[model samples]
Each structure stands twice: as structure tokens, then as C-alpha cells.
Target: MYEQKTKETDQSVMEFIEDIENIKKREDAYKLVDIFTETTGYPAKMWGPSIIGFGAYHYKYASGHEGDAPLVGFSPRKAKISLYFATGETERDKLLQDLGKHTSGKGCVYINKVADINVEVLKQLIDQSVTFLKETYPSE
Candidate 1:
């Protein structure tokens, strides 16, 4: 069973993307949704309330920690877009080399706007993240 609750609204994803209070951020998220879906072949789903999640996977760690996380997800935060890749940093090297204008947090990638970075490289990063998760967590 899923614990996170997505809000109930008739608003379509496009509408929600356009209706974000921050115009620049809204546009960036929309563009990302489009590119992410196209690049990964996983359509965007509004996870929990705000995260734009792509695909999905199941995970269990050596410490017996386990759960299901979206294969690749991002949230358009007020300050920046938070890209979620449950995979840790060591596996994220070469892509990081090409990722521009972004900051990394533990397992999260924070970028100001897709416009400020190389969109193609960003797609590759996301794809790589998804692939890493799938390979690491093959049970899903």
C-alpha cells in the first residue's frame, strides 16, 4: 500500500505545471516533465503532493533498510528543483561531469532551472539514475 497522499484536484498535470506561483520555476518543471518522459519513457506522476516522479523501483540495503522509491523523481522547490536518485554519489561521477549549474545533496540533485543547464545532459543524468536504481534493485 502507498502511504503518501496526492491531493485531489481536477487540475491536469499541464494545468498544475502552469499554475505554479513561480512562473520561471513552473515553466522549467513543465519542460522537465516533457523531457523526462520522453527521455526515460516513463511519464511523470505527481508523487505525494509535489514531486514529479518518473517510473519506479523497489530497494533493500545491506543494513536491511528497504522500501520502494520512484525510479527518478524531482520536485520543483521554491529555491530550486530537487532531483531524486536513490543511488548514492559514487555511482554518479561521469554524469556529474556533464551536469551544469547544479548542486548535489546526499542523493539529491538541486538545479536552479533546466534553462540554466544542458537539457540533454540532464536527461542523460536522469536516465543513468533510473538505470542504476533498476540494476541495484533488480527485485523491482
Candidate 2:
């Protein structure tokens, strides 16, 4: 289980992306940040060293693991950007249809770039994920 580290710092997150001097990646990162905020109405904050997180959700797993995590977050990795969501395939089996081409891991969805996915579908994905998290983990 991922331990809740100290809240992510702006300096750390900024430094983590310092090497990503590629104009395209940097632009995409900013673009995604803006989209995340506009669509979800949750201000974006950098989480840890790389993730741009939005909103928040509390989760307690079946094994008793519990923590507060961003309702949706993403890290612009060197190879791809990760989209975080608080849902498993069971609740998202059909939801992925509209997500365009993307891969999943547990509650996260990974997209190499926004271009690979339909922007409109991505919006729907975020909307559904946020709704699911809000409804399922209202205490957070």
C-alpha cells in the first residue's frame, strides 16, 4: 500500500519536471492541468514529485488500508501520462468504451498523450470517476 507521504510540495513537483524541457510535453502538462480544473471544478495541485492532482477522496480498502488521495490525478511520465481515477473495472467496464484508447491498472487509467484519446471521452471519464468517488467516499 502507498503510504500517504507529506503533502506534495510545489518545489518538488516543479523540479521533477525540470528535465522535461521538451516543449510538447510541457505544453501538454499545462493543458492537462487546465482541463482537469475546468472540467472537475477542483483546483489542480502537484502531488509528490510528478502528479498533478485534483480534488480529493478518502479510501479504505478491504485490507484496512486507508488514506485521502486526489479524486483524479496524473503524472506526465517520460513515456506516458497517468490518469488516476477511483474506480475498478467492475464499475468502469462499460465506461472505458468512451475513454478512447487507454490502458488501466486497478483504479488508474494511463494515456500516453491526450491526442491518443478523444478529449470529449476523457471528459466523460473524469466526470464519471469524480461522481463515483464522491458518492462512494463522501466522508472525504
Candidate 3:
């Protein structure tokens, strides 16, 4: 009966962006919204308190853990902007090489600013994440 803490919320995405203290991060958040929306053909939705997500899919692992998560998303945190994408795709590493200044974790890509990364590569990551998630976990 474990519940997910980061489930989608009804919060307003703009209101969340507007609350960002950093003017540059706020602006970058807006730009990311536009890019993710255009690439995924899905409206931005507030995931949890901070994540702005596009589209969603439900996933159940072999261990029986299951949850619904955004196909593509990002968060403008105090340290850096974190981009969320599928973790297992090999092509992700290939694209990240072409993506300008960024560090990556197991499933999150961190960039100081939008200008620090190539926007086209960001779009490709978004599309690839959405495609991978949809194909991996098609809804019944």
C-alpha cells in the first residue's frame, strides 16, 4: 500500500513557474515548457510540487513496483535545471554527447541554463523518451 509522493497534481504550471525566485530560471522554465510541448504534442502538467511534465505512462517492474510517471519533464531547481528522461535508452548517451554543457545522473540531466545545452538535442531527448515509454508500457 505504498503511495507515490510525486503523483500528478492539479496545481497550475504557470503559477509554479511564476513562483521561481530566479528570473533566469523562470524564463528558462517557460522556454522548456514550449520545447517539451511542441516536441511531445502534449500540454504541460504539474507533477508533484515542482516538476513540469508532458504526457504520462504507467510502468510496472518485475519486482511488482508500479506507478504512473511523466514521459518527459524538467524542474528548475536552485542548483540546476534537472531534465527527466528514460534511463535505459542507449541513444540517450549518444545524444547527450552532442548536448552542450550538462551533467547527468541515473535518470536526470542537469544543466545550468537553457543556453548551456543544445535545444534541438533537448527536443530529441523528449521525443525519444516519450516514444520509448509509450512503446515500453502501452496502456491497456
Candidate 4:
């Protein structure tokens, strides 16, 4: 059976943020930590090797692929900050329209910096993602 490598771990999220070499990205990581935690009402946790995630959920596909994932998370990559959210939600697209300067993929949003985006919209995105995930996949 295939396994998921990005399971949540006991690793220190603060240590991960401190290891970020870029000062600005480091600062943004901390800011995101606060923003995500405050918005989602969940403490941050380390996911995989790089993502700082808030809350969590278990998901199983119809094809039998199943794994645990964060409700919302962000990684301060070398090139950009990656924001994770519930994909395929219609409101996600609508929220992105007011999210200010950012790019996105199927399930991630890429931002150059926190300053380039609207923090309020980001909060809305976080809240909506959590609500959508909980409704879509109720936790036991």
C-alpha cells in the first residue's frame, strides 16, 4: 500500500520557522502562524518537513487513497509562500478574487509576501476552508 509521507509530527513549528534563512520570509512565517492560529482557532503544527499547519482532517478518496492533512497551512519556500486550503470549493475561487496579489494551483495559493495580500481576505479564506472541510468530511 502507498503511504503518506507528510503526516503531522512532533517536530517544533517554531524551530522550523527559526530555520528559515530569509529574514522577510521568517517574519512572514511568524505572522502567518499568528494569523492562521487566530483565524482557525487551532494551534499550529509541523506537517511534512516544511509546512506549518493549523487544525487537521482525515480524508479518503473513492479510489481508496486516504491520508491526514492540515485544515490550513503555509510554507515559506525559497521562492514563494505556499498557502494550503480546501480545493474544489466554489467559495475558494470567490475568496481568491479579493485575496489581493497571489497565484494559485489546484490546492495551494502562492504569495510573494504577506504584504502583497489582503490579510482580511486571507482570514476569510482560512475560515471558509475550515468550515468547508469540516462539513465535507465530518470528524469523528
Candidate 5:
């Protein structure tokens, strides 16, 4: 049997943000909290030790691997801020075209700071991710 390490926890999101050593990153984290919360209509939650997530959904794969994950989330890492969004959403790549300066991985968009990207596009990404997840894995 396997278990998920990134399960939601009771850790305080504020404390985590405040503890960020980089002043700019800490400030950006706060702004992101507000942006994600307003965009998703969900409060910020600590996912694992570092990720600040909003909302959640249960997902099961064809291989029987299933777990609950945040609809969208982000982490302020030492190198860059990693934005997490739903994978396999076509609109995501389209929107990223107008998202300003950012590098994206398979599931994360990396930004040096909040000012480096378009906030509106970020909001759209958050909304699209949430909507996609809800549709892909409807609650039972």
C-alpha cells in the first residue's frame, strides 16, 4: 500500500509565509494568498510542509492510485515561486501565452516574483484549474 505525503495539515499558512527568509518572496507569498483566495473563493491551506493550497478534490487513476489534492496551490521556493495548476488542461497552455515572464514545468509555473506575471491570467489559471478538477472528478 502507498500513502500520500502531501496530505493537508493543520499548519498555519500565515506562520509559514512569515517564516520565508527572503523578504521579497515573503511579500509575494502574501499577495499570492490573497490572489488565490479571491480567485478560488477558498481559504489558504497548508499542503504538506510548504505548499499553500486552496480547495481540494479526490482523484483516482485507472491504476487504482487515488488521493485528494488541492485544486490549485503554490510554494515560494528559494529559486522561484512554483504555481501549481491542473495538468492536461489545454486552456492552460493557451493562457500561458499571455502570462508574461514565467517558466513552466509539467505541473508548475515558476515565477521570480508576483510582478513577473499577469495577475489576471494567474486568476484565470486558478479558476480553470478548479473547474477542470471539479468536472474531471465530481464528488460522489
Candidate 6:
């Protein structure tokens, strides 16, 4: 049996953002709060300790691993802000191509700050991720 580490918490998203040691990172986190909230039409929730997540979906794999996860989220980390989005969407790669100066992992886009990317493209990425997840894993 396996337990997931990143479950949603009753913790405060604002407190977490305010606790960010770097002023710029904290400010960027606030900006992201607005963007994600506006894009998803869902209020932000604290996921685990650091991730500010918007809208959630439940998922179960073929192997029976199952959990609820945010449709989109972001963490203002020490090194760079991590933007979480769906990894396998067909339009993801094309959108990332125009997302400005950022590097991406399999499931996260790393940006030094919000100013480094085109906000419109970022919104498009958020929209695509949410749409993909909803269609792929509709609520029960």
C-alpha cells in the first residue's frame, strides 16, 4: 500500500505566501493567486504545506492508485516558482513553446518570476490543464 504525501490541508494559503522569505517570490505568489483563481473560477486552497492549488479532481489509476489533486497549482520556492500543469495534453507542448523564458519538467514549469513569462500564455496553459483534467477525470 502507498500513501500520498501531497494531500490538501486546512492550512492558510495567505499565511504560506506571507511566510515566503523572499519579497519578490511572495509577491509573485500573490499574483499567481489572482491568475489561477480567475482562470479556474475556483478559490485557492492550500495543498500540503506550500502549494497553492485551485479546483480539484479525483483520479484512480489502472493499478488502483487513487487520489484527489488540484487541476492547477503553483509553489513559490526558494530557487524558482513551480507551476503545476497536466503533462500529457496534446496542446501543452505547443503552448509551452510560446510561454516565454521558462523551463519545464515533466509536470511543472519553472519560472524565476511571473514577469519572465507571457501572462496570457500562462493563462492558456492553465485553461488547457483544467480542461484536460476535467475531460479525462470527470467528477463522480
Worst 10 residues of 1 by lDDT: 2-11
**Residue 5, candidate 1: how far off, in angstroms?**
8.8
- Over 1-140, each residue of candidate 3 has an lDDT whose tens digit, in order, gives 97998999999999999999999999999999999999999999999999999999999999999999999999999999999999988799999999999999999999999998999999999889898889999999
* TM-score, cand. 4: 0.98
Per-residue alpha-carbon lDDT of candidate 1 for residues 38-132, written as tens digits (9 for 90 to 100): 98898777666677788877667698766666788788888889988755636476777788888887878898888778877777777778777
Model 2 stretches with alpha carbons more than 4 Å out:
1-3, 6-19, 89-91
Off by over 4 Å in 1: 1-12, 89-91
Candidate rank order under TM-score: 5, 3, 6, 4, 1, 2
Residues 1-140 of candidate 6: C-alpha lDDT, one tens digit per residue: 88888889999998898899999989999999999999999999998888889999999999999999999999999999999999879999999999999998999999999998999999999999999999999998
TM-scores for all candidates: the values are 0.82, 0.81, 0.98, 0.98, 0.99, 0.98
**After superposition on all CA atoms, what RMSD does each candidate show versus the true structure?**
3.3, 2.8, 0.6, 0.7, 0.5, 0.6
Q: Model 6 misses residue 127 by how many Å?
A: 0.5
Error of 1 at 118 (Å): 1.1
Best by lDDT: 5
Model 6 lDDT-worst window of ten: 1-10
* Candidate 5 wrong stretches, greater than 4 Å: none
Q: Candidate 3: lDDT over CA atoms?
A: 0.94
Report the Cα lDDT for residue 48, model 6: 88
